[model samples]
Target chain A: MSAPAILEVDITRKSFAGRDGAAQLVLEDLRFRLAPREIVAVVGPSGCGKTTLLRLIDGLDHDFTGRIVWHATDRPRIGTVFQEPRLLPWRTVRQNLTLVAAGRDALADELLHALGLWPFRDAYPPQISLGMARRAAIARAFAIDPDLVLLDEPFVSLDPTMTERGRDVLLDAWRRRPTAALIVTHDMDDAAALADRVLLLSANPARIVADVAIPPDQRRAGPEAAHVLAQSLRQARAAETRPGGAISGSSGRR
Target chain B: MLPAASTVAGAMLHEAVAGPLLANLGITLARVVAAFTVAMVFGTALGIAMGVWRRLDLALDSWVTVLLNLPALVVIVLMYVWFGLNEWAAIAAVALNKLPSTAVTLREGARALDRGLEEMAESFRMGRWARLRHVVLPQLAPYLFAAARSGLAIIWKIVLVVELLGRSNGVGFQIESYFQLFDVTGILAYTLAFILVVQAIEWVLLQPLERRANRWRR
Candidate 1:
C-alpha cells in the first residue's frame, strides 16, 4: 500500500457518439491507480465501461480523454487476457505461447507446465475444451513476463468448476511472476478470490463508487473470508446506488 | 463425326507415346505453370495491400471490377496484338485474366480477418513477419486455396486460347491442325490427354494440400 504507484489512471470524461448521433457518456471523473505488484479487481454492472477502462489503459481505444501515466523508464510490458481467449485458431497451444515471446522463451515452457497446458501443447484451439483454451490464453499472458497484466472477465462463460480452475491457474502464474494485475469482472467472488482490492462502479456513465481493500489476514482466512468480503462488496455497491451514498475512492482526480 | 470411346482412347495412348501430343501438351502446361504463378503471387500481394489499406482498396476496386468483368478473349487478342505475339504476351494475357478474381477473394479474406485476433497480435506487438506468418497467413489460407483452385482452372483454359491464337505449338494448335485435316480421333486424343492431366493435378496436388491446410478445422 505504501509503494509508489506504477500506473495512474485519471479519466476526466470519456464518451462516444450513440447510434442516434448523440454522445453517450461512459466513464466520467473515473480515476484509479495500481501500485507496483498490486492486484485490483474492478467489479461493475454489465456494460458499465469496465472493458472500456482496460482498453484505455491498454491503448486499444484512444478516443478517451485524460491520461494514463506509467511511472517507469519505458512503457510497461503488458500481458492481457481479454474477455475472449483470442487464441490463434490455426496455431497449436505451444505455438500461440511462443508467438509473443519473440520465438521460444523459457518462461513460455515453464508457464505451460505450471498452468497444466504442457500436455495439450500440440492441440489447436478447436481441439481443446473452452477451459483449456482460456488457460492457454492466461499462460500466454504470463509467458511475456509483463510488468502488468490486464484481465477482462477472465472466466465469463465457464461453469463454476471451470471458473474456479481458471482462477487457480491465474493465481498460480501470478504468484510465480508477481506482477501487478487489473482484473475487470462482474462477479464479486471472482474479485475476492483473485484481487487484493475491489473497485465498484455504478451503472451507465460509470463512475467509481467505492474502492474496498481486503485485509491481509482476512485474505489468508480462506473461502469463508472471501465469501464474507464478497457479500460486503455487494452491499457497498448496493449502498452506493442511493442518492447520497458514494463511498471513499470516488472521483480520483489529479 | 465424333470418334468412338475406344478409338479415342487408342488414339490418346498412341498420340501420347508417339505424336506431337506430348510436345504440345508440355508447352501448354508450361504456360499454365508460369501464368498461374504470376497471377497467384501478384494477386495475393495486391489483394493483401487492398485489404490492409482502405485508400488502396478504394482506388483499385473499380479497376479490379472492370478487369473482372472484362472478356478473356478480348484481353488475349489485345495482348497478342499489342505485345507482338511473343511468349511473354501469351503468359501476360493469361495471368491478367486470372488476376482479378484472385485479388477479389483475398481482398475479402483480408477484410474479414478476425479483428479480435488482430488486436491480440497488436497488443503483443508482434513483428510484421511474425504476424503475417502466425496470424494473417493462417486466417488467409482458405481464401488462398480458393484463389489457387479457381486460378489453376482458369489459367489452363486461357493458356489454350493463347496457344491457339498466337503460339503455334500447343494442344490448341494441335487441335487446330487436326481440325483442318478433319481428323476426329486426333482432336479427341489431345483433348482426352489434357483432361487426364488436369484430373491428375486436381487429385494429386490440390486435394492433398487443401486437406493438410484445413486439418485444424476438425
Candidate 2:
C-alpha cells in the first residue's frame, strides 16, 4: 500500500442553519486522506463549500460534525493563505511576513525577493496592488516553514501572467521542503499543476464526485501536460453533469 | 477676531490681569490632559470588550446610550454636589462626559474588524498579544484616532465648565470671577488664551499624529 497517510479526514455530515433557521446540509459523507508530504487539491465551483472545507481542515471551524486527524506525533503547524490576501492594512509587507514568520529571517527575505516584493517591503497593504498583497500573503505562509500549508484559491482574479508566477512561487516553496498541502481551487489547470491527486465536489451538501490521481512523474510535466489533464478532467465533469452518469448522490461514502 | 485680539492685548497690558491668567491657564491645561487621558483609556478598553463579547455588549449598551444622551452640565453639577467641589469631582465629571461617545466609536471599530484576518491569525497560531498588535489594533487605529479627535473637542469645553461650576483656580473659574465684576476684557483674555492653546494643540500635535497614523491609507 501507499505510505501511511499524514492526514485523515472523515466528515460524515456538515451543515449550517439557513436564514429561516432550517438545517441545510453542506457536506455529506466525505472521506479522504493525504500521504506524507503530498499535495492534494479540492476542486469545486464557487459556493460548493470549498472554503468551508479548508477552514475545517485548518482547525478554524470546529462546529462541523467530523474528524480531521493530523497523523503526527505532535500537532502540525499550519500556514494558510486565505481567499483574500488578509494582510494587516496598516502594516508594511515585511512586517506582515515577520509577524507570522517562525524566526527564519533568510527564508522570509528570500521569499520576498523571489516574489519581486523586496522593493515594496516597507509598503503597507493598501499601498501595494492586490496581486502584490497576495504575494506577501504567500510569502507569509511559506516563511513559517509549516508542516501543513493550506491555500484557498490563491490565484483567483489575477491575470494569466501573475497566476503563472504565483504558481511558480508556490511550487518552488513546496519543492524546497516537501510539506503536506491541501489546496482548494476552482481552476482545473491549477489543480492539475499543483496537486498529486485532484478531487472534485458536487453542488451544495458536497460529496466527492471524482478522484483523479496524477502519477508522481506526470505531476512535473509542465504546462502542456497540465492542459491535457485539465481538458480530460473537464470532460469527466461534463459527463457527470449529463444524464445517466455512473456516479449517483445516494452513496457518497468513500 | 478683532475683539479677541484687543481683549488679549488689553489683558496683557493690564498688570492685574497677567498673574491670574497665567495661573488659570496651567490649571485648565492640566485638567484637560488628565480628563482626556482617562476618558480615552477607559473608553477604548470598554468599547473593545463590548465589541468582542456579545454578553458584555448587551449588558452595557443601554447604559452607554443613557450616558451619551445625559447633559454635561447636569453631570458636572451633580458631581460637584456629591464630591464637595474637589479636583477629583471636576476631572471625573469631564471624563464621564466624553467616555460614552468614545466607547461608541471604538465599539463600531471593533465590530467592523475583518474576520478573514482573524482566521489567518488563528491558522498561523499567532498568540494573543501578537494578534492584537499586528491584526486587531491596526484595524482599530482609525476609530481610536477618530474617538480621540472628537472626544478632545468635547472634553476641553467640559473641563472649563466643570471649573466654572466647582473648581476655584482654572481658566473657567477666573472667567467666572471676571464675570461677577463685569470685567469684559479679562473674560475675553481667558477665552482667547484657551482658544489659542487649543489651536496650537490641534496644529502641532493632533494633525501630525493623524497624518502618521493614516500614512498607510495612501
Candidate 3:
C-alpha cells in the first residue's frame, strides 16, 4: 500500500463579506492530500486566499467549511514563517530562536550554524539586514522541530541572490526534519524550485484550478527549471482568464 | 562681588537648610520607590487581565479611563480625607494615580501580540504556565519595562506633591518651610538636590533598563 496521507483537506470552503454585503466565496471544494515529507507549493493570484488556506490548515482559521484531518495520532505541531520576518524586536537572533525551541538549545544553535547565522547570533533583529532577518525567522521555525511547516510568501522581499540562498537553506532544513510542508507563493520560480507538486488557485473565494506534479530532477536543477515553470504558469494563468474555463466564476473579482 | 557671592553660597549651605534637605530627599526617595513597586505589580496584573479577557476589558475600560483622567491633587486630597494624613495614605494615593497609566500602556502591548505565536505555542502542547513564561512573557518584556520607567517617573513627582500637601516631612515639606521663611537660598538648595537625585535615577536605573530592553532591536 502507498504511504498514508499525513494531511488531508476535503471539500474545504471559505467565504468573506463583499462590498455589497453579500457573502463572497473565497474558496470552494478545495481538496488535497499530502504524504509524509511531501512539499506542496500553492500558487495563486493576489487576494486568492492562499494565506487563508494556510491559516485553516494550521488551525488558525475556523470559519471555513470542511474537514482538515491530520493522520498522526496526536495533532502535529505546526511551524509557520510569514512573508515578513516576525522576529521579536527585543530579542537577539539566538534568543528569538531559542524562545520557540522550548529547551532544545543545542538544536537551535545547530540550525543557526547551518543557516550561517551563528556569527550574528547575538545581533538583534533590526541590526541584521532584511535577508539575515528572514534567515533568522527560518531558523526559528526549524528550531521547533515541527511535524508540519507552512510558508506564506516567506521569501517575497529578498533580492535575487538572497532568494537563491534562502531557497537552499529551506530545502536543506526541510530535508533534515522531513516534515510535510505547504508553501504559498505568487512566484512561479519559487513554486517550481522547491515543490514536489504545484497547486494553483483562482482569485476570490479560491478553488483548485490546477495541480501539476513537478519531476524530482527539475526541482534540483534550480533557475533553468524555474524560468520554464514561470512561463508555463503564466500560460496556465492566461488560459484561466479566458471566457470559459475552470476559474471563470471567480474571474470577475480578480 | 566675590565676597557677596561667597556670602550667598555660604548661606545656601547653612546647617539648618542642609539637614532637612538631606532628610527630606531620603523620605521622598522611599515614598516614590514604595509607590512604584505597588503600581508595577498591580498595574501589570490588571493589564494582563484586561488583555487576555475581553469581558474584563469591557468591564474595566470605563474605570481605567476615569482614573487616568482624574487630577492627581484631587486623589491625594481624597486619600488624606478618607485614610488620614499618614505615610500609607500618601503612598497609596501616589500608586493609585500611577496605576491606570501603566495599565493602559501595557494593555496595548499585550493586545498587539501576534496570534500566530500563541497558536504555535498551543500546537506544541505547552501548558498554560509554560505558554505564559516562554511565549507571552518574552514578548511582553519590552512593553513592561517601558510602562515601569514612565510610571516610576510620573509617580515620583506625584509623591512629592502628595508629601508637600499632606505630610509633615519630605522634600515637599522642606520646600514649604523655605517658602514660609522667604529663604530663597534654602529653597534653591533643596530644589537643586532633588533635581540631582532624579537625574541620578535616570542615569542609574531608567537608562540602563531601556538599553537592555532594546538590546535585541539593534
lDDT of 2 by residue, B1-218 (tens): 24567666778546235476777788899999999999999999999999989999999999999999999999998898998889999999999999999999999999998988888889899999998887888788889889988988898888888988887788888888988998877788778788888899989998898888778888
Deviation in Å, model 3, residue B129 alpha carbon: 6.9
Clashing pairs in 1: none
Stretches off by above 4 angstroms in model 1 are: A244-254, B52-55
Give per-residue CA lDDT, model 2, range A1-254, as digits (tens): 17899888899888999999999999888899988778898888777788889889888889888798877746787889887899988888988888888688788888888778899999988888888888888888888888788999999889888887788878877877678898998888898888899888887778888888887788957778887888887777767756745333331111
Tens-place lDDT per residue, model 3, A1-254, is 16689888875578888899998888898999988888899988766888888878877778878998888746677778877877766568898878778898998998988889999999878888999888888888778888788999988867778898999899878877778889998787888788888888876667787788877677657777777876776677667656555453322110
Error of 3 at A104 (Å): 2.0
Q: Per-residue lDDT for B177-217 in model 1, tens only?
A: 88899999998888888889999999999999888888788
Candidate 2 ranges with C-alpha deviation above 4 Å? A236-254, B1-7, B10-18
Question: What docking class should model 2 receive?
Answer: high
Q: Flag regions of model 3 displaced more than 4 Å.
A: A229-243, A248-254, B1-23, B40-66, B103-154, B177-184
- On residues B146-210, what C-alpha lDDT tens digit does candidate 3 reach at each position? 88778877987798789789998887887788789987766666666677788898899888977
| Residue A88 displacement in candidate 2 (angstroms) | 1.3
Native contacts, share recovered per candidate = 0.69, 0.91, 0.43
Arrange candidates by DockQ, highest first: which order? 2, 1, 3
Q: Indicate the DockQ of the complex predicted as candidate 3.
A: 0.39
Clashing pairs for predicted structure model 2, backbone only? none
Better of 2 and 3 by TM-score: 2
Order of all candidates by TM-score, from best down to worst?
Answer: 1, 2, 3
